[model samples]
Each structure stands twice: as C-alpha cells, then as structure tokens.
Target: MNPLIKKLADLSEKKSRLIIGLMSGTSLDGLDIALCKISGSGQSTTVQLIEFVTAPYSEEIRKQLKRISSVENVKLKEVTYWHAKLAHLHSEMILAALRNWKITPEKVDCIASHGQTIYHYPARDQQELMDPVNSTLQIGDGDHMAVKTGILTISDFRQKHVAHGGEGAPMAGLVDQILFVHETETRILLNIGGIGNFTYLPAKNQPKEKTFTTDTGPGNTLIDSLMMHYYNKPYDEDGNVAFSGDLNEGLLRELLNDDWFEEEKSKTTGPEFFNIPWLKEKMEKAGINQDELDPKDIIRTASELSARTIVKSIQQQKITSETAVIYVSGGGAHNPYLMQRIRELMPANEVKNISEIGLSPDAKEAVLFAVLANEMLAGKGFGMEIEDESKFVNFGKISFPD
Candidate 1:
C-alpha cells in the first residue's frame, strides 16, 4: 500500500485526531489557527479546542491578498504567486502555534484549512442573464501547506460543495448540526465573520428540511471597510465608535435596499458586495454627500445595518417558539452594540455567545473546519437533500505530506 494511504487508514482507526484547523476569512484581520482534538463524526462528533491563536497579517500581506480578492482586474501572475505565498505564511503560523503549545508537528494528525476566499459568486442569481454558475476560489495551496508543514492537509473544502450544487458557503452547518444542536431546542448558529451567516438547526423532532443555513448579509465587512478607509483601524474594537455616533436612518434605509437582501435564502455574499464602494453608491442614491457625513455616523449605521439584516433574515425563517436560542460566534459577537441590538430586535429569543457552550466563540470557525476534516477521515459522509439531492459528498482535497 502507498504510505499515504496506509497512514490515512491508521488515522481512521484512531479514537480521536489532533487536527490544526486554519481559517482566514474575508476580514483579512488575521489567520485563525485552532489546534483541535476532534473525536467521532456526524451527530456524534465532539471537539476540544486545545489551543488557538490569531496571527495578524502585516499591512503589506493584507494589501496583497486584497488585491487579488475581488472582481477588480488583478495580475494573474500575482494571484498565482500569492496562492503559494499564503500557504507558506500559513505554514509558518502553524509552526509558530506548535512551538507556542510545546508540541511537535509529528504529533498532529492533519491540517484542515478553510484557506483564503479570494472570490465567492454563488449561483443564486439566474435572472442576471450574464452567467449562472456556482463558483468560488480560495487560495493558499493545500499541497504547499502539506509540504511545508509535513502534515496531511485538507484544504479547499468549498470547491466540493460547489461541485455538489451548494452555494459553497455556510458549510459549517454540518458541523453545527453535529456538535451544537440540541435535542429539543431549535438553535441558530450565527457566525458573524467578514460576512454574516447562520445555520438554523431545528429540533431533532422537526423535519430535516427545516434545517437550513443562509448568509444574513453584511457582518463586519461594511463597518470594517469604513473603519479602514476613514479611521485606519481594521475594526471598530467592540464597536465603540459606533456607540459614540447616532444612526443615520436615511443612509441605513438606502444601504438596506440592495436586491441581495430580497433574494432567496441560503444565499451567500462578501465584502465584494458590501464594501466601501457599495456603501458610497447607496449614499449617492440616497442623495447623501459621502464627503460631508461624519465617519462615526457611517460606522454606526453600518453596524446597525448588520444587526437589522440579521434580524430580518431570522424573522424570515419564522421559527416561532420561545425555546430557540441564538448562539453567536465570530468577530461581530465581540461588538457589544451589535449584540445588544440583535438582542433588542429578537427579545423573545435568548441571545448568547457560543462560549456559553463548549466552544469558544472566537475559535468556532476554525474548530468547525477541524470537525469537517475529521469527518472526511473517519465518519459517514454528508448527503445534503434540501433544494436538491447531493449524495455522500466528502469535502476537502487531501494532500499527502510526501
């Protein structure tokens, strides 16, 4: 047998796996490295976050990533170069994490990487008549990661989902269903990264069709973009700037008028859709002078827009029952204003950080990737049967260390 195949088979027999899950989101804030010990799979999946750290990207690195991360014309050579460059950087981060935890790379079983999403164009928009294909690209070569880290790597998980007719997003739903769902309680697993998305896991008694996930529009992307352009801050830091400013209702309404909001559920979007240019266009439409507007007000409205869109999406679900709880993760959860507003909007539903459960809210996304990787190695694969029937699709492409 090939050494790689034998090693994988050996791993499958293990009771658990020490997997390093890496997630670099659209926020470009940092690379979230989660050292996870995952056991079992599917509904029986369990994960313990052994260690975690967010290695912040230098401005130069961030700029290079952003350059290749949108519809804007970029050099193909640059994109090709950064794909491996990012993988090398990620490997360095992984090594740093291992050193920090006083562990050796050999002790780890595998690396599950979400990679860096340079573009996401889900096929939800058929009316456009331009192009209709579910396409997404996440760089950071898994082969390079595998070679550099000397660990079997599973990366580019989204491509499989797209190939299987999924929107290539909210893939965390499977893990959430396995690890976070309650027997009787309907739970909303909300992740507010650069783009906000949630997995609505109905009670076990509910029909499986009722269990769905969708992107709830802007998360921190709009606010973060404004902060960067205006204040030179990557983020609002707990939304203090937002708290200090009054909401601009007119601009808020204009921002909320995007057709993306009215589109069908289970959709996905990114900073590519909700960034500064998008906001400026909305302001222009609303007859608001972008130059004259106070920076704080813009930030305040962006934060409120995020909260409102989230609430609107939840409301669309129409999950009526006082037993539901909203478990929020991702950077937006740290924003007190956003959290308070979400709670205010949905007073009946209990809103809490995922930390109240076993997983740290900050580590949830990385941990989720780890869970998916574990499932690929050991558990029964997922058969998604919602709008379409997808059979036993195992996400992630395996890269052998050799």
Candidate 2:
C-alpha cells in the first residue's frame, strides 16, 4: 500500500485534524490563509481558528490576473503557469505563517484551497453557446501545493458542484448548515465579496427545504472596477467616494434592469456578467453618457444597486417576522456606505457582521473551506435530496503529497 494512502486512511480515522484553508477571492487583493483546528464533522463539528492572515498579492500579480481573470481568450500557457505560480505563492505564504506561529507543516493534516476563481458560468448564463454546460474554474494546482507544503491537499471544490448540477457557487450552504444553523432563531449568512451572496437558514422547526443560497449580484466588483479606473485606487476605501457623490437613481434603475434580477433565485453570477463593459451597455440603454456622470455618482449608484438587490432577495424569502438576524461577512461588511444602505433597506431585521458570531468577515471564506475539507475527511451522507435527480453533496478532490 502507498504510504500517502495509508496516511490518509489514518487521518480519516482520527478524532481531529488541523487543516489550513486558503482563499483567494475575486477581489484579487490577497490570499486569506487560515490555520484551523477542526474536530468531529457534520452537526457535531467544531472549528477553532488558531491563526489567520491576509497575505497581500503584489500589484504586478494583481494586474496580470485582472487582465485574464474572466476573459475567454486567455492563453493556455498563461493559465498553466499561473496555476503552478499560485500554488507556489500559497505554499510560501503557508510556510512563512507556520514559521511565524512556530508550527511545522507536519502538524497540519490537509490544506483546503479555494484557489482563484477565474470564471464561473452556469447554463443560463451561457445560453448562446452550442454546448452550454455548467462550468467553473479555480486555478491553483493542488498537486503543486501538496508537493510544496508536503501536506495532503483538497482544492477545486466548485467543479464537483457543477458536475452534480449545481450553480457551483455559494457552496457555503452546506458548511453554514453544519456550523451555524440555529434551533430557534432564523438566520441569514450574507457574504459580500466581489460578488454578493447569502444562505438562508430557517429555524429547525421550519422546513429545511426552504433554506437556499443565491447570489444577490455585484458586491465590491463594480465599485472596485470604477475606483481603479477613475481614481487609480484598488477600492473605494470606506466608500468615501460614494459618500462624496450624489446617488443617481436613474443610473441605479438602469443597472437593475438586467434579466438576472427577475430570474430564479437559484441563479449565480460573477464579475464576468457585471464588469465595466456590461455597465457601459446598460448606461447606453438608459441614455446616460459616461461623461455626464461624475465618478463619485457612478460609484454611489453601483453601491446602491448592490444594496437594493440584496434587500430585494431577502424580501423575496418572506420570513415570518422582521426579527431574523442577518450576519454579514466578506469585504462589503467593512464598507460603511454599503452596510448603511442594507440596514436602511431592511430596517426591521437585526443586521450584524459575522464577527458577532466569532468569525472575522475577512476570514469567513477561508474558514468555510476548512469546514468543507473536514467534511470530506469525516462527514457522512451530507447530500440533501432536491427536486432534481441530483442531491447536494460534499465536494472536493484530494491531492496527495508524494
């Protein structure tokens, strides 16, 4: 028997595992490395975030990725090179973090990497394609990570979901159900990264089938794009630009006219569909020239558009009471302008960051990956039967270090 396979079997039988969860989101800002101690699995599982940090991506790396982030015309060689490069970068970050924390790589059982999402296109979004299949890709070769770090690794989680007929996103629902589902309180886990997404958690008494996850559209992607284009800033820090300018309701309305808003709640999207080009097309349709709009106003309108879609999606759920708690996470939670608008739109609900529940907003994504890896190691029968022939299942492909 192979030593790696034997080691994995031993890990599967262990009562606990130390897993490092890595996330490089659509923002391309940095890598969120979380050293998590996870014990048990399923409803009984527990995660202690022993260490966490955001290792910033250099400006050069960010630029190179931004150019090819979601475009279809990328060179195969570039993609292949970045796949290994990201793995090496992640490995270096992990090693540096381990040194800082005085822990060795051997202490860690696995690395759950959410790699970098290059593109995500569900069937609905690719209706024009002759063979429109639900597809998504995250590049950061797990094989390379395992080789560099000498730890068993799990990555490319989304591919499993797509293969099983899911939108291949908002995969957080399984982890949320495992870790955060409340017996008596209604909860919504809202994550606003480059894209805004949420998982609705009904109280135990409520039908579990009612619980679902969906993307509420743009989060920081559009605003971030405008900021970079107009101000040479990566993001509108504290939403200062939005606060400085007037809200253009007309432009806001134009932004909301996309068919996506009215589509089924199961839909998922990314910066690909909400990029500057899409915004420009919408502006033209609304007869609003780019020159006529101040950069600040553009940022403000984009911000409001995000807020409105979020509110609309939550409202569509029709929770029995206004007392449901909304735990916000991701980059948007830190943006006062965005938070204020969401609060204003949902006045009766309790709105708070995930930190209130003991997870840093910035660290939630990485931590969730840790939970998924734990599930793969120790969880059983996570698949929940849905209307379709497919069932929601545990997702991750493991790579062994040789």
Candidate 3:
C-alpha cells in the first residue's frame, strides 16, 4: 500500500484529537478559523468547537481577491502570488489566534484549510473547452501553513470527493452528520454563506438511510455585490439595504428562471455562475436600465431568491423518516432581512442559529474541516470515496514541513 494509505490505516483506530479547521468561502469576507476537540469517529463522532474566529481581510487584500475571485480570464500571475500570500496571511492569523488563546500549535493534532475558492465548475454541462467531469482548485499553499504553524495541515478537501464521482462541494454533509445527528429528531444545518447550502440530518430513527445535503442557491453573494456596487461597502449591514427596499417582481421572476434551480439536490454553484454580470444580462434582456435599478432592490431580490430556492428544495425532499429541525449559520444569519425571509418561508421549522446548538454558526464550517484533518491523519477511512464513506472519509492534503 502507499505510505499515505498506510498512515491513514493506522489513524482510523484513534479515539480523540484536538484539531484546527480553516475555511474561506466565496464571499471574500475572510477566513474562518476553528479549533475543535474531536472525539470518536463515524456515527459516534463528536466535534466540540473550542475556539473560533474569522480573521477578516484587509481592504486591499479584499479588493485584490475580488478582482480574480470569480471572473473569467483573470491575470494568472496575480492569482498565483495571492495564493501564497493567503497561506502566509492565514498562517499568521492561526498563530495569533493560538497565542491569544494561550495554546501552542503542538497541542493541536492537525489543521484543515478549505483554502480560497476562485471558481467552482461543478461537473455540470460538458463543453469542448473543458472536461466537466473532474477538476476543482482551492489555492492557499498548505505547506506554508504547516511549516509556519509547526503542525500538520490539510487543505483542499474537495478534490477527493470529486475524484470519487461527486461534486466538489457540499463537503459539509459529513460534518453536519457528525455534529447534528439525533436519535429521534431530524435536523437541517442550513449554512447561508455566499451560497445557501443545507445538510439534512435524518434522526437516528433511520441510520441505514442515506443522508442528504445540497447547495440551495444564492445566499450573501448577490446581496454583498449590490452593496459594493452602489454603497461602495463590503456588505449590507444587518441587511439594511434590503430592509429599505421593495422587491421588483419582474426581476425576481427573471432571477428564478435560471437553470441552476432546476436541478437534482446534488447540484452546486458559486459567484462565477451567479454574479452581477449574469444578473445584468438578464435585466438587459428585459430592457431594464442597470443604473436605474436600486442596489437595494438587487439586495432584496437576492435575499428573496435565497428564500424561494430553499423553500423549493424543502418541498422536493423525499424525507419521511426524520423530524426536520432547521439550524442556520454564516454571515447571512446576521442579516435580519434574510433571516426574516427564511422564517417566512419555513414557518414551521425553528430556523435558529447554530449557536443555539452549542456551535458558532459562523465558525462551524472551519471546525468541520479541522475534524476532517484529524480523520485524514488518523485514517478514519482509507482509500475510500464518499460513496464508500462506510466511515466519514478523512479530508485535507498533507503539507510537509521543511
């Protein structure tokens, strides 16, 4: 067997670990770093979020990142350089976070970094220019993180899932299961980040049944764009912009007609596929003036789109064995307008923040990948694809120290 495989085989039998997980979503807001103490594996797996924080990006870095994040044909050199800079920046943040908490890097067993997603083309329509069946890239030099922090670092967790005939996203499913599964109560961990993704945790009433998770639609991406485009700010504070605006019915319907929503739950998307350019095209097709359209209305429409997409998905679920409870997290949770819309859509579900369940809604994803790093180093499941995640497959890439 390969040495990596052999090492993983040795790891699967461990009982507990202290790990750090890092995530930087498409919103370009910042990196969410979570420190967790994980015990057990598989259904018995438990992740305790010990310390969490999001090290926000500086204005300059944010602007640079936004330039290439989801656009087509960006300057290659800049993207390459930023990838390393991000690793260094994240490394410094982790070191600072650890020191502030009085915890040494050695005390933590492993690190998981989701890296920065530039673009996500989830094996959708194939074309002559691309091989849609496989490929996904998240750049943030993991080796730099491992060397600087003096700990084993696991980054880029999505490739393995894609290698196994799965979309590179919605990797949140396993962590959602490990953290939220209950014997008699079903749970839906809805992360309303730049994109709205959900993990449906069936009550332990049916452990044998398959779990469900998928990206619903736009979350904060569009709302954030409207803010920057008009208000010259990063994002809408408390969703004030949307709160102040009225929804434009024509725009809302046009937004809803995209083929993104007409897919099986396995689908996924990103800003690359749903940015201002796309929305502008749609509006222009309808002869709407891009300048006259209120940025506030754009924000409101995005929020409404998120709500409608989520409701549509919930209505199509085939679940019958679990009692569904909704737990929300991410930047969107702080958006009062978005939250209100969510409650209006799913009035029956609790629709509370992940904090209500003893987890930081904002820090959950980072901590999950941290646990995934522990799994990788310890071999929770070796040479297994998600399809054979008989146990949760270990995630992350090993970053060697020099």
- Tens digits of per-residue lDDT, candidate 1, 18-64, equal 99998889888789999998888777778889999999999999987
Residue-wise lDDT of candidate 2 within 274-363, one digit each (tens)?
Answer: 999999999998899999889999999998998999888767766525757999999999899999998888888889999998888999
Model 1's number of clashes is: 0
- Order of quality (lDDT): 2, 1, 3
The 10 consecutive residues of candidate 2 with the worst lDDT sum are 384-393
Relative to the unseen true structure, what is the Cα RMSD of model 3? 3.0
By TM-score: ranked, best first: 2, 1, 3
Worst 10 residues of 1 by lDDT: 384-393
Whole-model lDDT per candidate: 0.86, 0.87, 0.78
- Candidate number of the best TM-score: 2
Model 3 lDDT tens row, 1-402: 977556445555557888888999887878888888888765566777888888889888888988878776899998899889889999999999999999988787777889898878766744655455755678888988888888777787888777756678777887676668778888888898898888777777866766777888888888788788888888889878888887988888888888878876567788877788888988977677878977778778777887788777666676522257788888888989878987887777777888988888888788778766766765447332233233335565687554
Residue ranges of candidate 1 with Cα displaced over 4 Å: 125-131, 207-209, 384-391
